[model samples]
Target: MTYHRITSIDDRYFKPFHQLLQTIFPPEEVLEYELWREPIQDPAIYVYAALDGEEVVGATEYRYYKELRVAMTDFTIIGKASMGIGRFLMRNREQHLEQIMKDSGTVSLGMFAEIYDPYRAGIHSFGGVSPMNPIVRREVLSHMGYKRLELTYVHPSWDHEGAAVSELDLCFLPQNEELSELPALLIVSFLTGYYEALPNKPEAWHAMIEQLKTKETVKLAPL
Candidate 1:
């Protein structure tokens, strides 16, 4: 199996990969297929897949904010680790992002991910026989060295008509081991731009950003 980066929406595996995400995640968690089309051409956005003989088995997506020098791990779906593809794709993705930084002569502060709060998120069946347990997912990510940020995180609405999603935790994998804390303003800035780029946002989005403004620092804790 090989890892493939989808730089164009025309890639044959692009649609299939989106279909796979729809199968595994609920509507709120997965972006619409058409939404993937525009970002595919943006240098800041990245989408990749693990393929076995042209058949996509797993995929990951992320974005880099050049000004912030940070990357966000938006979505990833790698099945059971027993298959080893999960680890492979993850390591490759990190390396790819590092390469991007190197080519640009810039260094990333860290990579961020938003994970469901296991206790609060409950179980998501996604029409599958086996439901997804956030607890298990958290454990898996914890083993990979992702540390949860200590903050009241509420996901902004994905679109104008959507409501804010709660029970989510922001996780970070820092570029430097000695780095332990980040200024609250960094997160506030990133989130402000994040929401503004969306089609529309609700009051909760504004409230969350306002709350972040009152914090001096955002600390990280073991997941």
Candidate 2:
């Protein structure tokens, strides 16, 4: 019923996020838990999380695209909105991802997933029905001032021809400890855009965080 931000120190939840991904996603996609929980010795990669109470329900684990100068939402937003908790959790995740942006000076964040937000409203409205449960990715690119190019490649799957699989299989790795009420599925929906319909792809889709540079273009247009 509450939102919690998963920090590096919060070992209790971080492990689960890793374990969960390992079980569901292909080993190739799952990164080491320690590498993600610890600070980026690389100066670019940063790890973050969102929790329900003390339970880590959602997470962002990826290397900041430094050379390319963009941060990609790697994977790990997992929570349930059945009780309306996912939305609140998203606010925290966005804020965290934004705070990390100060260093790179780039808004172009990239991510991979399989589906879209079934509950998303605003500039990110998607109309197509998702065969998968629907996962959404976050790319911090638009803050750089490009919405169209900002969303050029927002679907998951480096290999579109690959098969689909349950993200849960990735989440249940032995190292992951199950949190009480955290809905990892719904939380994943907002970040990675993966659904159940496709079961062998291992991974599915991706997205970027979109924003508009609204300036005072009109002075007397308020009539």
Candidate 3:
């Protein structure tokens, strides 16, 4: 398996990356190909893909907040399970972010992800309901040291005008005390046994967390 950062949509891995997304999300939930391609071009966005001999099996995208020093996982999809591709892509993204911090003389307080609530199903246009399947993705994330922070918020739906029914869970790793004041259920993982649960913890995992702690604390915008 090979893992690399995607800098451009034309970077040879674009087609498979696009296909992987199409295969995962429903038609209405997926963005138009052109529209989706735009974010990958933005320098602030980081896209990583996992390939098994040239076939893109998994892809993860993140948006970096320079001022906040936070990297948010915007979306991640894995075409196959139990291959360990998801974990590979996540660790790669974290390493990439760490390098960015080192180059900029900043520190990343934590990595975060917002996922649709797996328990709920959305109403479909054909009168049938479409269930949200975030279980597999959530499991992979939890194993990677990300704890589910009790920050639940309703994300307004784009498909249904003026309706905000999508509930999302906000999760983060190496929790900070400052985050607890933000009116969210903050869960932190004690690195001890958690790493043992992972298939293989990245060599830099512990060092990276220590480096992150030395940086300035993340300031939360008033809620």
- Tens-digit lDDT track for model 2 on 1-223? 3443345545565676666555444443444565454443334445555556666555555544334433344454444434443344445545655676666566532332222223441232122212113333222221222122112223323233443322221211111222222232323333333323223343233222121122211111000
Q: What lDDT does each candidate get? A: 0.77, 0.37, 0.57
lDDT of 1 by residue, 1-223 (tens): 7888898768898888878787777677666777767768876778889887877777888887878998888877764335666677778988888888888788899888988776787777543522134666678787877888888777755533557788789888787756788888999888776655575666776787888899899898888
The sequence of per-residue lDDT tens digits that candidate 3 reaches over residues 139-204 is 656565665553333333323232343445656654463453222211123222222223333334
Q: What's the CA RMSD for each of the models?
A: 2.3, 15.0, 12.6
Clash count per candidate:
0, 54, 1
By summed lDDT, the worst window of 10 consecutive residues in model 3 runs over: 123-132
- Candidate 1 Cα errors over 4 Å, as ranges: 79-81, 126-133
Sorted on lDDT, highest at the top, how do the candidates line up? 1, 3, 2
The alpha-carbon deviation from the true structure for residue 93 of candidate 2, after best TM-score superposition, in angstroms, is 3.8
The alpha-carbon lDDT assigned to residue 141 of candidate 3 equals 60
**TM-score of decoy 3:** 0.66
TM-score, predicted candidate 1 vs. hidden true structure: 0.89
**Candidate 2: where are CA atoms >4 Å away?**
1-10, 23-28, 32-43, 83-89, 103-223
Please say which candidate is ahead in TM-score: 1 or 3: 1
